[model samples]
Target: MADLRTTNPDPASPYPLDPADVTPAGPPRAGAGVGLAVPGRATGERGFVPPASLADFAGLARAALPAEVWDFVAGGSGTETTLAANRAALDRVAVLPRMLAGVDTPSTEAALPGGRFALPVAVAPMAYQKLLHPDGEVGLAAAARAAGVPYVASTLASTPVEDIAAVGGTVWFQLYWLRDRGMVADLVGRALAAGCAGLMVTVDVPVLGRRLRDVRNGFALPPHVAAANLPGGRDDLAHQGTPGVSAVAVHTGAVFAPALSWADLAWLRERTPVPLLVKGILDPRDAVRAAELGVDAVVVSNHGGRQLDGAPGSAAVLPEVVAAVGERCAVLLDSGVRGGTDVLRALALGAAGVLVGRPLLWALAAGGRAGAEAALALLAAELRDALILSGCADPAAARELRTLIGG
Candidate 1:
C-alpha cells in the first residue's frame, strides 16, 4: 500500500530541486496565448514573471488586471471582513521548525482520495475562467497536469469537462447540486465517463451569496461562456435569474439551487462510484455530520469568502473540524491559501491539503498556461522550503511541528 504521508524539504540543507521541479525539465507548452506563442503576450516572449509567494502574485495580478475583473474575482461579500480574516488567521499559525537533519530531496506529495498528487495544493473550481483567458479551464488543467497537481472542475467551467479531460489528465468534478436532479445526474454520468477521480459536491450555496462587488460591477455571464451540462434556452429565466435583481438576471440557473439537502447526498452517492467530497464545510459539528454521512472527505471552506460575510476563516475553523472528524475521512481546505507555508499551516492543523483560489485566476489572466505553471512551480518551491525550514522531514513530521497559539 502507498504511504499516506507528506515529506518536507530542508531550507538550510544542501537539498536542491530535482529535474521534475524545474521549468526546462518538461516540454515547452503554450497557454491561452490568443494567437501568440506565449500567454498574455503578443509575442512568444511572455511578459509577466510568476510570483514566488501569494503576496508577489497578488501584486502582479493587481497591476495586470482591471479593477472590475479583480473585484469580481478577488472581492468577498459586503464588507469583505471574512476575506481579510482568512489571511489574518493563516498568519496567526506559526510553524515550529526542526533543526539540522540529514535532508536531501524534499517532497510535497499528498495522498488524495483517488490517488496522490505531487503537492498538497489544487486549483479551486472557479466559473468563467475564459474571462481570465481564452483557454480557460483547458489551460488550467494542462498546467495542473504539468505541475503534477489536480485540477478541480467547476460546473460553471467555460470549457467543457470532457474537452478539459481530453487535454489534461486527472480531473475532479465540482457540482453546485442544482434544483434539477436530472441535470445533476447527467453531469455525474459525464464526469464518471470522463474518468474523473472524485466528485466535490458544494453544499453551502443554496442561493447566490451577496457579492456586492459583482452587483456593483454589473457582472453578467458572458453569452459565449455557457454551462455545457445545461441546455440552451432563455425561457427558463425564472430558474436561472434572481427574482428581484436585474444586474444578475442573466446568470444561468446553474448558479443557484434552493433544493439542496443532506437527503440529496444519498441520491448523489448513488450516481457515481467516485469518492464523494463535501465542500463548504466550516463547522466542526458539520464535519462530524459529513463523516457520518459517509463522505470520502470534506473541504473546510467559506466559498473563498464569496458567500457569508461574517463567517470565520476556514483556517481558523480547521482545527475544530479536524477534531470533530477525527480522521474518519480526508480533510481538505481552501480560502486564503497562497503559499507553501499556508499548506504547512493547514497541515499542522490536520488538513490533508489546501486549494488555491483567486490567485490562480490572476496567474491565468496575467500569463496563461505558462504563467499558471510558473505559479504552481513557485508554490512547490515555497512548500519545499517551508518543510525544510520548519525541520519537518516528511508529512508525518508536520503533526509534531504544530503549536497551538491560544486555548
Candidate 2:
C-alpha cells in the first residue's frame, strides 16, 4: 500500500474525471466593488492554449496583477529565506525512473474519505483572492470542479463560503480559530451549512506573524473591500480591532490569541462534525501528536513560507512528517509546489497530495476564472505525462518508482 493517501489504488484508470463532471461554468464575473472591467474581447480571443510549463503560467500571471497585491500574496517573512528555500528544497530531490516498464498510461486519481481528486493536488485556502481577481475563491472553486480536484476555502474568503460551494465541487474549509469560542462555533456552523466536506483548522498562527511587507505597504483593506465577516466594519481602513498595527497608523483592536496550546485544539475539536485536518504542521513530534489526537489529516506546510523566517522548507520536512504520521492520518503537502515534476517529487516523498499557492492568485490576476482553469488543465496534463514517462502507471507506483531526477 502507498504510504500517503491517493484517490485510486488501482493503476489502470486512465481518465481522472467522470464524463459528467466535464462541464465548466462560464467565465467568472467580477465581485461587487472590485471595479475590475473586463475588456471587450471575445472568449476565443482570450486564447485556449496555455504555456508548456507552470513557469510560463507564472510569468503570464505576474504580468497581470499590481505590485502591492502581488507582493502581499507572494512575499514571505524576514528576508524570505524560508520562502526561497521551499522551492530550492524541491530542486534537490531526484525522481529515479524505470525503463521498459510498459507503462503506457498513468492514473492520477487518489481517493479520500470524502471523495477523490482528479490529480494529487488541491488549491490551498487563501485570503482575499478577489484582490487578485474579482471572482476570487468562486472562480477557483469552479476551476477545481472542472479539473476534478478539490478546493479548500479560507475563513477570510472575500466571496462567501456558500457561493463558492454552489460551484458543485468537492470543497473543504480552513479555519482560523478565534479567541472567542462562540465565534469559532459560528464559523464552523457556517462552513457545515455551506456543504463543506472537511474542516482544516490552521493551528500554527497562535497570533498572526509579523508580516513585514504588509507593514511596509500599510496593507489595510481599502474602505470598499473589508472582510465582510469581520466584526469591525469591513470597509473601514482605519478600523483596528484585535491586533494592533502601527504600520497603518491605525490600531485594529482585534488581537488573535497568542496563548494557544494543544489543549485548546481539543476544545475547538469538540464543536465540529466534519473531518478535521490540521494545517501548519512541520515538526515530526507535532505530526505524531496530531495523529494520536485522531485528527483526520495533516497538511505539512510552512504557511507557504509566509510565517517564520529561516524555518525548514516544507520539502525538507515532508518525509519526516510523513514517516511520523505513518498510516494514522493522511499527510498532505504545500509550500512552493511549482509544477507536475514538483508534484511527482512530493508524491514520491510520501505526500498524499500537494497544494498550489501564489501561482493560482497569479493566474487569477492574469485571466480571472479562465486563467485559473487553464493553469489547472495545464498541470493535470503535465502530471499525466510525468506519471507515464517515469513508468509509474498510478499514484501507488509513484511510491516505489525512484529513477526520476529532480531539478
Residue-level lDDT of model 2, residues 1-407, one tens digit each, is 12111112233533232111112223333331231423212166344456566655544443444434445566676666777778777878888887788988788897554667788888898876777767678888888899998889987777778888889888998887666767677778888998999888887776555655555555555444445445555325433323324222232224345566788778766766778889999999999998888788899999877778778889888989988878999888888887888888888999888888776765666567787788898888888888888888887788775523344
Q: For candidate 1, give the lDDT.
A: 0.70
What TM-score would each prediction reach against the true structure? 0.84, 0.84
Instruction: Write one digit per residue (lDDT tens) for candidate 1, span 207-269.
Output: 667766555555555455555555666224422434234234345334457778788887777
- Those runs of model 2 whose alpha carbons end farther than 4 Å from true positions after fitting are 1-48, 231-255, 403-407
Looking at model 2, which ten-residue stretch has the lowest summed lDDT? 15-24
- Clashing pairs for predicted structure model 1, backbone only: 6-395, 7-394, 9-388, 10-388, 11-388, 97-390, 98-390, 98-391, 240-253
Q: Give all candidates' CA lDDT scores.
A: 0.70, 0.70
